[model samples]
Target: MCLLAMSNSLLQSAKKVILTEAQAVMMLADGLDQSFIDACQLIQNCTGKVVLIGMGKSGHIAGKIAATFASTGTPAFAVHPGEAGHGDLGMITQEDVVIAISYSGESDEIMTLIPIIKRLGILIIGMTKNVNSSIGRISNVHLDVSVEKEACPHNLAPTSSTTVALVMGDTLAISLLINKGFSVDDFARSHPSGTLGRRLLTLVSTIMKIGDDIPIVSADTKLLDALLIMSQKTLGMVLITNNNNILKGIFTDGDLRRVLETYPNIQSLTISKVMTPNCQSISKDRPAMAAVQMMDEFNLNSLPVVDDNNQVVGAINTHTLMQAKII
Candidate 1:
């Protein structure tokens, strides 16, 4: 073939691969039935974690499914089927649910261990192309991930089938996550080291400066004294509170610059005269992400964290959040 023909053929093959996978997903959605609901209920009510098992390409998809399940609130892990015969079956319990994936639904490695898993009285959720396959016939719930054709021209490779199985796994995990009322905080707790986890799980108190480090001054104080406090704290802002520790206003460097430009008698003014009244504040218990959002919307560099009684408890700045990798 000419080089031009080869390139055209390659592009057509890529397009076919994408379309086949996309169509498989759509067909899987159309075929979703009560079995999908049953599968979700089993996972939601399981007292223990989900155990996923499969072979070859199915095993790879099972691993991804296990990860999605674990991160979404359903504690789950993947175990290879061949390894199950070698004693990994002990990892499952009667209170847990077992999900097995196989394109043919009767991979010998998977079939050989089905009896042992069933003997444990563990509920089985089978994902396969044939609902009548050995694993499916015995499963408490069966998800048919059948595809009409593989993306491979020879129809030998696991292409559309694996893609559909993966989509089905995601469907199960996300549905279970929703049924369990799993919130962003719950997901973050499960993945505390990742970026999304850091943003959602990191608390304001974790990054906020407390005790003597908080830049605070009385409303009756002089502007020069407040600026000194701001300089000492280096947070670019001074919190103005009442003698009783009630936050009243805040005067930031922005406010100072504005005052300097808008007023001629800067040296004679009190802090309250130049302060921004009733400035926005956040709760110390709130997530750091919330603070970042507030700062972005208001173009602020810092905010005072208040308690239920509206008393300043701590102070957080953009720099601190950035340093903590929570922004």
Candidate 2:
């Protein structure tokens, strides 16, 4: 009974936190200002890199924002304000744009670097809640990210304010991305190690079974022989090719089942007699995601991959696509 009561209390607390965060997000959405546009314009017009600076939790969010900008076509990097006072300030050039993040706009670490940054002639964009604070007053462009209260019960932690800052940063990055005509292919190039890259950049040639691994049989081959080859390849299907090695049709598991039901004596039938004549085929250079879509639209589990001359080059199955995370 004690454990059950504890669990109930924890669940209730979690729900309250979620509701508070939702309310805070709504407040941010309602308080959009022109200062946001000014900040974006400054960054967009910057001739050099974007330098993001912040302290504590704001610093972590600023780092993520800098990474997003760099990956999405805008060249940017995060520099700790405290380190800027040492020697890291050299990373900033006169043509660069600096973005400083602080909830109260009076973080001592960030304040100490402002004069040096200004003396360097670098453009300054301030992201803060207080418009009259030191950083805001000195900045060329000020973006307001004020929040009514934090999601934290004591209102001491940077919860809602950090969320607002992150959203604002994402908005700026995406706006610049669109303005620069960043494409899906460009994103794929930036993320080559993840599932997104595999889905967008992986070609049929990379995943399809080629040469000896492909289950192929001549049109005159018996259905039983084709089934044996299909079983050996473990692809659940076999392709029917002409004497010129060109794809003519496909004999899949479904076709075998239908043939068995329609003609119980199909064991002795020729493969060409029962195969699907108008089977879907894809090019070797087609994107893996496109192949998955074609299979889904045609209600097929496998497809024959062909070359420019319509010759059967390879075959791919749903399992292969699943392993590659293309579906």
> Highest lDDT, which number?
1
How would you encode candidate 2's per-residue C-alpha lDDT over 39-151 as one tens digit per residue?
77888888999999999999999999999999998899999988888999889899999999998999999999988888888888888998789988998888888887887
What C-alpha lDDT, on a 0 to 100 scale, does residue 207 get in candidate 1?
87
Angstrom error at residue 195, model 1? 4.4
List model 1 lDDT by residue over 1-327, tens digit each.
Answer: 999999999999899999988998999999999999999988888999999998999999999999999889889999998888888888888888999898888889988988877788888999988889988898889999999999998999999999999999999999887877998778778887778778888899888999899999998899988899999998889999998788998988788889989998878789999888889999999989999999999999889999998899999888898898875
Q: Going through the candidates in order, what is the number of backbone clashes in each?
A: 0, 0
TM-score of each: 0.88, 0.90
Question: What are the per-model C-alpha RMSD values against the true structure?
Answer: 2.7, 2.3
Instruction: Report every candidate's CA lDDT.
Output: 0.90, 0.89
- TM-score of predicted structure 1: 0.88
